[model samples]
Target: MFTENATLMLYVENVQAEYDFWKTAGFEILSKETIMDYDTFDMKPHADSTLTFKVYDKAFIKQISPEVADFQPSVLFETEEITELHERISGLTDNISPITSTPFVSFNFASPSGIYFAVKEK
Candidate 1:
């Protein structure tokens, strides 16, 4: 059985930049530390879940597990004001896709390290 204390870890090349992006997007940083040669930042996406950003040596990751270097997870954030969030993210990065309205209003944006995530209306 699993508990509500779930965390999604994202591996990135630049830890500070990714951390700044998430912080600028209004995610609160809980803690940051370096463990086992990897720099990790714990951020609160909501009250119950945490989103972690880990910075590791690319070559070392490739040597240990090549597939890990290319991993990109699709993370979604629920927002009540989609347009406001979209505008905020659009001003920060140019990697945001146009908001679509097929099933519901949603759009995806990329961090400086090229990790893509979506914000959907709640």
Candidate 2:
């Protein structure tokens, strides 16, 4: 049986920009390398975090697996300080939605690559 989430594959057009975005949002880089003529990076929330996000350039993925190059999974992250996190990421992009409480205290923020993700209060 599956135990836990270890890594998630993320495909984007630009690796450097996404790298800066995640770094500015408090994510720590695990590793970065040039593979198959494309830049790739592995990042996580912190050192001890169980989950990881492996970033890859879309063009590279297209060369390897054209059919799956456009699949982007929706991610929902949990945080204890929802408001603080939202405030911190506010200046990063204008596509962020303000914290809403219709169903829960949560907000959605988009990465520089235009993939939006949600953060909900835990």
Best by TM-score: 2
lDDT of each: 0.77, 0.93
Please provide TM-scores, in order, for all candidate models, with all chains considered together: 0.82, 0.94
Q: How many residue pairs in model 2 have overlapping backbones?
A: 0
lDDT by residue (tens digit), candidate 1, 23-64: 898887888886566666778865555444344545446666
Return the TM-score for candidate 1, rounded to 2 decimals: 0.82
Model 1 Cα displacement at 61 (Å)? 4.5
Clashing residue pairs for model 1: none
Where in model 2 is the C-alpha error above 4 Å? 1-5
Model 2 RMSD, rounded to 1 decimal: 1.3
